[model samples]
Target: MKKIDVIVKYFYPLAAGIEINVRNVYKHMVSHGWDVTIHTSTDMPEAKNSLPVIDHLDGMNIHRYPWRWYGFVPRIDWAHTPAIALHNFNIFPHSWLLIIVLIRRTLGMSSPKVFLTPHGGFTPEWRTFSPLSRFIKKTYQEILGVHLINAAVDGLRSVSDWEAVESIKHGMRPDIIHIIHNGLEREVYTQIEKLANQVTTDQVRKLGRYLIQIGRIHPIKNQATGIKALKHLPQDIQFVIIGPVTDPEYKKSLDLLISQLGLFDRVHFLGVISGVNKYYWLRHSVVNVHMALWESYCNVIHESMSQGCVCIVSRGTALEELIKDKINGFCVPEYDEVSVADAVKYILDSSHARQILAMRKRNTDFTRGHSWQNISLQVEKMYTTALGS
Candidate 1:
């Protein structure tokens, strides 16, 4: 069987949305009789550099190269061209890998068909990036990166319809675009639900009448807005934030805001969690809030819904496709405090609890199509199509 080369910025000892999605899908593919090798960095820019090493996880081969000099450089030795090269997260490693492949092809060497998955990084909303970074990225794309992505890639894999439109706007050929939504491992959720139903964990119950938001603590997550929404709710309503602090300054700002609002006791920040502990909170929280500036498709929303937790997401994101306001879930018009507060208040009010529970019961039926096993089959078909192209 021809092997597929997977290039990502980081793998293992770190958990991000893109990393989780790649891990789950490829692991499924491997089990289904596909050969997948992941080429990734040992650490991200924030972590200390280390020597390169090779590792394997659940039958998937991983080559972890030292990410010295801020993860901007990558060292890869391709003994032979792979059948397909799928690049996730279009940053450093992807750019460098593309350059190397293009150079090899130019020298009459074997070249694998390339696939690009920007993972929501190329949407027009990306124009909101900090001025200095935005200027540098736009200039690079206009001068070289855009052309490389358009001319060299065999296909552009999109996780949502909105993402597909964004890629087309950025010069990728529409014919080569494929929309493959992210998948959920139902078995994982089944196990979690079993644990969550047994008893409310003391740690989660201690927070009392809280709402939860699970993701990185970054400005793009729009967490400050969620904090401000607390003003509109009853004082007893605690707000629990669960995720790794990706940005210290942003966390400080959140802390400062918590102090300013005098919500020291009411607001709680529980750093990164997974497994049964994660599901416990999701299963019990009054609402799961995910109001981000832009998200390709948030896995947490599906996880929360699967656990029978009511979800309130921001409108205009890919999440809009999965949620229906006043039906399966709630969608706020904007990420502002007023909008979020209104959505929360509506769901938390005593009168609405019955309706919310009704929707919760229907969540599993609605999300049955997202099984990761089925999604891997769709990915396999796409791989076949890309190789044929």
Candidate 2:
């Protein structure tokens, strides 16, 4: 572990799970005088033409390459990094980089000690896709994904125990998998601490009474569940949705459903918010309802809880680990419409005000303990294990 470099195909500052994980964790590593470098893609849709190909900041070497097709990036000949970490989700860098490692190992080229953190990469949920898409995923996961990992990867960094099963299904060794969850940024908690006092009457009026679902609009995310839950809540409380529409068709279906229910006025969609604006909305909201079908790990859950907002998350996924069925917060059975509605209504009911406040207190205490500084130490141990030092 002489030099620590991370590879994530799509890297942005202070956004998304993988990007934020890299920014927070590696910055701590850099402060400790560890050699931290990040290799990422120059395909930032938000920045368009603004990002430079090469830059250096926060005591790290930032290298950006043009992404051509299907997570493909042109390789540059630079000094080798002995230890490399791959941040993965459904696709991109991990899937593509795995192929590179396979080819390199097959050609008898020198291989780095690679560790992979699979944030929901190649999971069983892909079976829900269309036949052609399913075939492509199956072929990749069973054939390429497994072989590449077995050939080159030295260890696995899993965010939760739930994902260890998914990693094993893809043929990763269980003993080598490290269960290290993501953590909240210190600044985020700083903002929450500032809100310990009551907000003014005007400030409360401005924020409005609402429940929020913050994530990309996708069918797999099950945003429709939130809409259905809204039908059970009171009329004054609108459902605030803040995330980009990654799937327009799904968004259209939600619009149609809202029209059918005649609740157009009660459902507000504010796409892709960040920084304090997003936090203010979450902090002042009535509650946060997230019913995504599957997740390797969810950062929004931690963010919502840290702000003392009660969360109603789905069960049988990584969310269960976060919202421990009334231990900290609530977990409705996933896709059970009646159960979901009942849970939301129960928390919102005036009779249960004391109970909900207790839950909020427990949630904030639990979430506050998981800061990035704590997570960095766990990640450094994973790196050391992977490097066998």
Candidate 3:
């Protein structure tokens, strides 16, 4: 099999789920005897001084491109503006290197089967979020980004069917859309589970029953709604919001809402816990709640479920496909505070029922078809098909 050159915008140090996915895919494909090289932006200062070059990491080659620095942007103000500005100003510049690399490869200067996974870039929610910015993005997508990506790649990979559909809506060629769910490494999942079980014995004694919500602290995630749902819950139960404080203003607003609802003590903001702590919290919590308005596919939901933590996700999108109501987990109407509260309360009150459902639905085998090894095999097939091999 020939080597595959994968191009992505930026990765690492951010600890975003998409970054993790990119890293895992690169690692797994190399392990499977496929020559895989990733092109990404470099964090190195000296590399930033250079333009249109390649930087090597371990045995994996990462091509670096100069990105324009937008210095000292206030987080609060930026959050209100279109998310695309964040992407355009920082991430999109790296993508322009794709054209340079493609031209070089066409001129017989480089050789590899090329593949592109834009991560969540092709989604409608991201495109539709800002009007003027959306127009700019749409123009870029149609003329430069989409066409270049289609022409440059041997295959297109999506994290979910939702992503594929969204890409098609934006006019991507249908035959090229390949669905591959992001996966949890088996070893990592095992380590987390073992650590979680040990911590459950210690933490369950102190925390009692609680709900866990994990993601970036942002308006789209609807943390305020979770806080509101706590107001409707009995005093004995609590809600724990975990993950990085990505938006300070949104965090402040959530704090104010919690205070107004008088849930200061009841709702806890455990900012960005990971490693053993993340697993421990997931293991001890009675259920996981994801109230985000949009998701291509959530790693948290799959990870929690793999750990036997029942989830309450919002209806619509790929979430509906993952969760079946009252079975493995529950799906309440999106943004319905009452429904969310009622669902949480029912799960808390009926521990035995929740446990039974969880046990039945619990997936201990993280290496099931969703593993990156398996997904990469499927990606390899797509590459072969695209090459007409």
Candidate 4:
């Protein structure tokens, strides 16, 4: 059997949930007797200075490339820069570099099957800011060196149905797009149980329960609505926001709102807690509140439920597909702070009902079906089929 080569444009130290997916899938594929190599780039300072080469991580081969640094100087207001110009002048260079590396590796390999999992970066949401940005992305998709690299791939792997739909919109053959839900590491579930014990003991000392929200503090997540809804809740119940403050302006705005609403004490911003601390927060919280305007699939929801934490999510995008209202979790209308508050209050007041529901949902074993082991099996089948054809 030929080896499988997977090209992912973004990988590690980025710490997005997608990173977990990529890492686990790579490991799983290698364990299944598929020779897997992941070509990627790293922005970590230590990685930046080293020679760009392949290294063994877990069971897979990881090839890292040096990304061009535009300047040593950093700007305070980077988002203010025109996105289209940045896409054309900066991001495309990395995309092309990835293409060149893919071509070189593919030529030297023994007719290995190639796969590209863009990991949400190639979506319209990321590139469709302006007409020019859309035009440039479409042009690159159609005729650029990126397209040339894409053409060599046997199949395109998408993490969600939304991504598969987008791939078709971008002219990828529907039959060639495979929808695979990203998987959580088995360690996350184990850590959640350990965290529950710690948080439950600590909860005895603290006043009332907390509603937790986790993810990057960015405008795209619409966490401000979650902060706003905190005012509507009873004084006893607090809101805890845990995740990296990726956008300073957004964090500032959230801080201002917390002050204006007199929720300074009621709302806690726990910046970027990970590992055991992350699991502790999730396991301890009364309810996991995720009100993102758009998300392919919120891994936190799955992680929270794995720990038997009840979740309330916004009703839009693929969230509706992942969360069945009143079954696995509660779903609220978009931007309706009152609905969010109502759901939280119901979960708080009816703790027994909520726990029963959450436990039933958690016990359903949704994560088992979506495990990286199973996903890798599917991908291996695709690779074999691609090779045979």
Candidate 5:
């Protein structure tokens, strides 16, 4: 069987969005008689011990390489320093592995076609980057990425059209860019059905008639705007934020803002929720408002929509692409509290209950197209095209 080569920084866990994409797409590909070998880095921040160097699961071979967290530079304890005040530059050793594997294939030493998924990595602009970080990003893209890495890749997968456009602005070719959105597995909806009969989680029951956003606590995810919008909302409707605090300094600022706005009581944070419990909150929320300042794609909104949760997202990124501005759901500016408040108000108003129902139906119907099976077919087609047949 022919194989596909996917080179990325992380792959083992089913935690992050990028790995989830690989697992879903390639898992389905295996069912369609294709094999995959994922080349990934070994920097597991959460693991107590190193994961195995090689393993097989779901009929896919995995090769893990040793990787430094900050490459040649020292890893900053992001908790102590403000993110904007610091910067570090480092080379991605994955590029070396990619070039070597691609050359081997070119010399008829290997058969797999090398595919690259940027996975929210190749951005023209960095939302949270420090000054030196921005310079280093440009240097890497112009030197290593454009001249060598892009030339060696058989295909480049961008999760959103917005991501594809930004990558082109940096170094990638438009012709090689494939806009494949992240998708849902059958397991996602099945989990919802099993949990539907059970009582909602205590967190959900405690904050009845609430809005929720699920993503790491960072400036990029823009949880502050959700909190800001609450001042304009009724007292009964609160906001719940779910996810680990990846940015401690940002969380501090959020806490301060929460106190300043007198919204400390209304905004609750449930860190790191998963499986049935996570979906329970999603299902019962008045709406899932994810106004992330930057994203290649918003997987949270996709998952929420799958479980019949209405959403309000920001425009200009893939969030807008998923939501059609009050058609399926609402779209507001990333930081516009008034627009967000208005959208929430519209949803809660007794007059718009019928409208909300129609939106929920449309959202679920739209999400059906993003099934992992269809994503696998598209991915298979990309690999075939790379083979020049």
Candidate 6:
């Protein structure tokens, strides 16, 4: 059977956006009878029981290798298989993987056709995020990264137009780039609807009339804006934040801000929710909010929209493409207390119940067709094109 291998920084037990997206894509691939194997770093201690561990998730194969001090080394045994390698993200671990693949090809050893997905890793903010990241990527791209991409990769997968533009700026050929929007599993809506039926009056009271924000708790997510907006919203309109704190310092800052604003009671953090409960919040929320510094594309925004919840998302990101200011959802013009507060208030006070219902219906109708199955089919076409080339 033909096989495709995925190379990413982390997988399973880690709920980063990219990991989830990859998992869903592979799952859909497996369902279509493609044998898919994921090659990723073993970042979670729980998944590190054995070296080069193999597991099955969503009917796809996952092979996790432990990370080394310098970087990752793809297993020598898998080299002979001559698989199609999909490299997710272009930094840290994947740089080493790409280099290793290049050297093997140079040595006339078996090598896989590579497909690169930068996942917005090359954004302008990347340079300011860390000095090492800037130096490593800049130095490598000039010397090796761009060269390897040009020589080894069959194509690039871009989640948004912004990412496609960035990839071109970084020296990838425009012809080989494919832009496919990210999508959620269709079952998410089913699970959420089921959970909505089970939601009782007591649960609603406990959850409160809150504006929910779901995503990894990192500095880039700008969760503080949501917390501050509580002061401007009605006292009963609380703020509920969901997702794991990927950055401890950012989490600490959010906690400090919550305390300073005397919103300890109004602001609730329910960390790392999934499945039915995750959708329950979105289905029942007054509105969902995401004020990220930027996004290649936000899966959570679609998740919220699919669950029929109107969203207040940050402007000037890929999210803007999903929302048309007050048409289907609200957009925060700026990530400030005033901007967020005003957006929330507009949704609350201005949008009539009937208009809000119409907006929700529009969102649900749009995202209902964006299933993983359809997305994977588009990817399968790309795979065929890659092989034909």
Q: Model 6 scores what on Cα lDDT?
A: 0.76
Q: What C-alpha lDDT, on a 0 to 100 scale, does residue 133 get in candidate 4?
A: 70
- lDDT string for model 6 (313-387, tens) is 888878888877889988875467787788777667754878788889999898877987788788777876776
For candidate 1, the 10 contiguous residues with the lowest summed lDDT are 68-77
Candidate 4 Cα lDDT to native: 0.64
- Give the per-residue lDDT digits (tens) of candidate 4, residues 159-239: 678767866776666766777666665556454544545554564338467888888787767788888888888778888
* Model 2 TM: 0.85
Please provide, for model 5 over 244-274, each residue's C-alpha lDDT reduced to its tens digit, 9 standing for 90 to 100: 7667889999999999999878998977777
Report per-prediction Cα RMSD to one decimal: 2.7, 3.4, 7.6, 7.8, 7.4, 2.8
Off by over 4 Å in 4: 1-6, 33-37, 44-56, 59-63, 69-112, 126-135, 138-150, 188-207, 275-277, 351-364
Which segments of model 2 are wrong by more than 4 Å?
A: 44-52, 55-57, 74-79, 89-96, 99-109, 191-204
Error at 116, model 3, angstroms: 1.7
Which of 2 and 4 is ahead in TM-score?
2
Which candidate wins on lDDT?
A: 6
User: lDDT values of the candidates?
Assistant: 0.76, 0.75, 0.65, 0.64, 0.73, 0.76
Alpha-carbon error at 156 in model 2, in Å? 1.1
lDDT winner, 1 or 6: 6
CA deviation > 4 Å runs, candidate 1: 44-46, 50-52, 68-79, 84-86, 89-91, 187-193, 196-200
Predicted candidate 1 versus true structure: per-residue lDDT over 27-145, tens digit per residue: 88888877788878776535655535788886788888776443444333454645545545454656666777788788888777787777876663564578897886677776777
Worst 10 contiguous positions by lDDT, candidate 4: 80-89
> What's the CA error at residue 262 for candidate 5, in Å?
3.8
Better of 3 and 4 by TM-score: 3
